[model samples]
Target: MTPTQIGLVGLVALFVLLALRMPVGLTMMGVGLVGFAALSGWGPALAILGREPFVIASNYELIVIPLFVLMGNFATVSGMSRDLYGAAYAWFGHWRGGLASATITACAGFAALSGSSVAAAVTMGRVALPEMRRYQYDPRLATGCIAAGGTLGILIPPSTGFVLYAILTEESIGRLFLAGVVPGLLLTALFIVAIYLQTRLYPELGPAGAPTPWRDRLRVTGQASSMIGIVVLTIGGIYAGLFTPTEAAGIGAFLAFCLAVARGRLAWSGISSLMLRSIRTTGFVFLILIGAHIFNPFMARTHIPSDLAELLVGLDLPRLAVLGIVLAAYMILGTFLEGFAMLVLTLPIVHPLILALDFDPVWFGVVMVIVLEMGLISPPVGVNVFVVKGIAEDVPMRQIFAGILPFWLAMAVGLLLLIAFPGIALFLPNTMIR
Candidate 1:
């Protein structure tokens, strides 16, 4: 078969495996190895399978993944997520719909530590849901806030999404992290506004809480100081050129471990659990990366990216129009595909197109992450929504989906703002010291 036919058949097989509930990493690996062997030779395919995994796994840069995952696991165990929620609640709980707003605020703070959306949602849901319920907030609004807020994990600094994007596209990790800052904050603010408007129009959705005194608010914020400090030092260190991203991850993980021990939350058993969890998650990420690497060569041989780019450029559409179409495709895929799966599947094709258009890679990474965030809340495969539902089992699934609609629209608005003013994603990256 011709190279195009081989690539096409491999993709079809990959999709079939995905539909059969096969792990994405294995599916991609299987299809890629077969396609490569068909196009090149089994010997070359075997050579890649032997060397690629080690090359991808041993790269010092990828150490950031497990270390950051460890940091997040430690933070979860130490109850920093609860502290964040309490502080946000202290600040926002008194307003109408304040609890929901507070949930978003807490999610943003926690996102700085935890790079995984499901982790952010599950942790915040535990801390915020009970409080929202106690305050008589509408279940839909409460749950919606958690689902939407959790997506900040991908857009905030220390984000795994950005890490993966940086690795895949050969962009600077520091630049991508910096790029996400303003956009992450923008999305968080948009989510807060959505909550306020939702409550304003229907005050019954989120009842106000008893106001906390200033002293009490200060004390709650103080309780979260360790977590806040770690975030500042870790991301700040990278921005200031004091640490590489990998070094920052190590420092962050070490400090998180220290914080957990200091808080008396780190028993030997708990440490073991954190290690195991981080290792497992790291293995999963590494597998996905390996699969993408294997598939990338097969794709390169097929000339699909060039063909697609040529086709796109030949259309003579405005650059902005082309970008809109790409983003729209992501939004649709986000509704059905897992975020990482979508990234591994599309980045080889999309990233080249992005460069062909002369768009900034860092800016595109931020935009891609934001679109992925939207997918985390989109229906059918809305991972964050399902996470919230697991925590709020008494709430109907449909209600959780309904509740996320406003926040979803908020994400849409955030996307448009970033598009119109690319500065939102570029300002920090552009200011980078190097």
Candidate 2:
């Protein structure tokens, strides 16, 4: 069979396995192993498999994944999320729809520490949903805010998705982390605006509650000093060249652990639990990385990516038009695929095309992240939505979806702004790196 036919068949098998609810890492590995054997015989396939694992496992940069995951686990177990929510609530809770806004803000702050969307959604759901419900905020709006806002995890610094993208594309982890800052803040701002407008347009949706005193608000902010310190030590250390990305992860993990222990939240049992969870997640991610390494070389040998790039360039489409089409494809893929899964599946094809087009990789990375962010809020298989639902089973799923609608629109606006001004993503990376 032609290599094209083999690649196509492998992809079909992948989707079939995914539909059967097979773990993503297993599906990719299964199809990739078989495809490699078919194309180059079992002996060569085994040789590739033998070497691939060590090659992937030994990379210095990959160390950041487990460290960052450990940091997030420690932060969650330490109860920093609750403090973040309280501070945001104190500052914003008096305004109409202020509770919902606080939820989004809290999610953003929590995202700084826990860079997984599911983690952010579930944690914020438990912390903020009860408060929103207590204040008679619309259940849909309250739950929806947590679900959509949680997606900030991937766009914010320390994000696993950003880390994975940097690894795959051979981009600087520090620069990629820097690239996300503006876009992440812009999306967060957009979410806040959406919440404000929603409540203003229909004040009945989010009733105003008693306002916190200025002194109390200041006190709440002061209590959040630890979080500020963590952010400074972790992100600031990287940008200032005080630490490599791996070292930054180590600093983050150590600091989170120390903070948790200082707060009396890190018992031996809790530490054991956090370690177990981080190991499980790290194992899964590493397995998927191994599978992609096996599959990517085979795909490159097939010339499919090159062929696609040639076809695209030959079409003579405007560069912006081509970019639009790619963004649309990511939006559609986001609905059904996990963010990491989508990245692994498409980057082989998309990255080559993007490089051939001479577009800025940093800008492209930010665009991809924003589009995936939309997927986190999309319907049917939106992972963040499911996370919130898991935490607040009493809230109807329809209302959760409805509540995210405006935020989704705001994300769309943010996407357009980034596309029009790639400078937003590039400015920090260029200015700081130089």
Candidate 3:
């Protein structure tokens, strides 16, 4: 049989395995290994199994993953997320739907430290939901904002999603991180504005809280100021050419550890737990990379990427039209696939197609991450929606999905803006001090 046919069969098997609830990493590794052995021989396929795990494990750029995860754990234990929420609430809590706005703001801040959507959603939800409830805010608005806001974890700096994208595409992690800054902040602002507008139209959906005294505002801001500085020092240092992504992650983790210690927050048992979680998270990311490494080689041997790229270019469609079609398919796939798994599974093909279309990889990285996260909150299987529902158990699943609509729309609007004006993502990366 032809190699392309073999690749197609492998993809079908991939879906069947996934449907059977096999782990994504193992499924790809198994398919890739079998496909490669079939096309080339047992010797080379076994050699790959022996080599790729060490390669992915020892990758220097990837050390950033565990460091950032550890930083997030330390920051969580330090109560920094709560402090950030408190500070935002002190400033914006008086407006209708203000608590929801604060949740978005704080999630953006926490995303820098956590680099994870589930962490952002769960942490911010625990911190913000009770207060929103106390203020009689609409459950839909409360839950929706957290779910949507939490997705910022992937769009903001130190994003695991972006890191995986950069590695897959051989793009610069620093550039991708900077490229995300404008779009991430823009989406955060759009989410806040969407909530306020909704509240303006229906006041009872989110009632205004009493205004905070300036002193209280100053106090909470002081409480969160150190963590904010740590975020700035890490992400900003990268833009200033003073730190590599790995260096920044290391420094951030050290500072988080220091802060946790200073606050007396990390007992010996908690410290051990934190390290174990970081190691597991890092292992999870690395395992997927190893799988993608194996799978990519097998796909390359099949020549499917080159063939598909040629076929698409031959279609003579307008570049944007082709781009739209690609993104549309990604949206459908991402609705069901976990973002990172889907990202790795496709970039072997999509990156070449994107490069063929003459789109900037850095800008496309930013746009792609946004689209991936949108699917996370979109209907039928909104992962983030379910995450929020998990936190707010009293709220119906349908209500949580309904709540996500505006924030999801806000994300769509933000995606469109980034698409129309690519510089929104590219400007920071393009003009980096280095």
Candidate 4:
């Protein structure tokens, strides 16, 4: 059979395995390795299978993943997540749906540190859920907000999603991280607005709490300042060109470790256990990267990505129209596909079409990350929704999804705003210091 036919078979097999719930990295590696052997013979394919893991492992820039993840784990062990949540709640917990809004605020803050949506959801949910419950916040709204808020992890700085996107496209990770800032803030604000409007429409959903005294609020904020300071120094340093992203990640990790030690929340004896978990997560990310690298070349040989781009560009649709089609396709794929798998599988095809349409890569990267965020809360495969359910198991799954609807709509609005004003994403990146 021709290479195209083999590629087509591989695609079909990949989806079938995914349907059977095979892990994304192994599935991609298997299909790509076998498909390439079909086209280029077993010797070269076997060499790649043996060689590519070392290549991916040795990538210096990729150290950012493990370092950033370790930073998050340290922050968690330090009880910094609770401090951030407490500060946000001190400020916002009195407003109607204020508890939910505070969850978003806290999640955004933690997302800046953790860069993992699952970590944000789990960490915030553990602290905020019982409070929201005690205040009698609607289960749907309480759980929904956590699930939706956690997605900020991927759209904010130090995001693993941005790192993966940058690696796949060879774009600047710093630029992509900077690009996400304004939009991430915008989306966070929109989520707050959604909470305010929702509770306004149905006051019972989130009753107001007794307001905290100004002195207490100030005290809580002071307590949380350390977390705020660390994020600013790390992400801000990267933005100012004071250091590379890798260096920022390393600094953040050390600061987080020191904070945990100072707080007596993490024991020296537990260091090995913490390192093992971080290494495991880092290894998983590397496996995905390796799979994408192997699969990308095989897809290139099949010419599917080029053919699709040529066909789409050949149609001469308005660039916005083309972009709309691409995003719409993302929404559909996000319904069932896991976000990481969906990303590596499709970027080889979509990234070129995006460039061919003349969209700014940084801008598109930000836009794409938002789409991925939407997928995180989308039905069936909304991973963050599942995270919320695990935390609030007493809350029904449908209610969690119900709560996500408003935040999801808010996300749509944020997406539209970014598209209408590309500068929202491009401004900071464009202004980066030399």
Top lDDT: which candidate number? 4
Question: Per model, how many backbone clashes are there?
Answer: 0, 0, 0, 0
Q: Each model's C-alpha lDDT? A: 0.91, 0.86, 0.92, 0.92
Root-mean-square deviation of every model: 0.8, 1.2, 0.9, 0.9
Give all TM-scores, in the order shown: 0.99, 0.98, 0.99, 0.99
lDDT of 3 by residue, 314-411 (tens): 99999989998988998898778878878988899888999999999999999899989988898777788888888899999888888888887888
Model 2, runs deviating above 4 Å? none
Candidate 1 segments whose C-alpha is farther than 4 A from its true place: none
**Candidate 4 local lDDT, 1-434, one digit each (tens):** 87778889999999999999998899999999999988999998999998988998898999999999999999989998889888998899889888998999999999999999999999999999999999988998999899999999999998999999999999999999999999999999999999999999999999999898999999999989999999999979988999999999999999999999999889878899999989999988998999988888899989888889999999988999999999999999998998888889999999889889889988998998899989999999899999889988888888889999999999999999999999999999899996
Q: Which residues of candidate 3, in runs, are more than 4 Å off?
A: none
Candidate 2 residue lDDT tens string, 69-110: 999888888888888888998988888988888888888888
Candidate 4 — which pairs collide?
A: none
As for lDDT, the candidate ahead, 1 or 3, is 3
Measured by TM-score, how close is model 2 to the native structure? 0.98
TM-score for predicted model 1 compared with the true structure = 0.99
Q: Indicate the TM-score of model 4.
A: 0.99
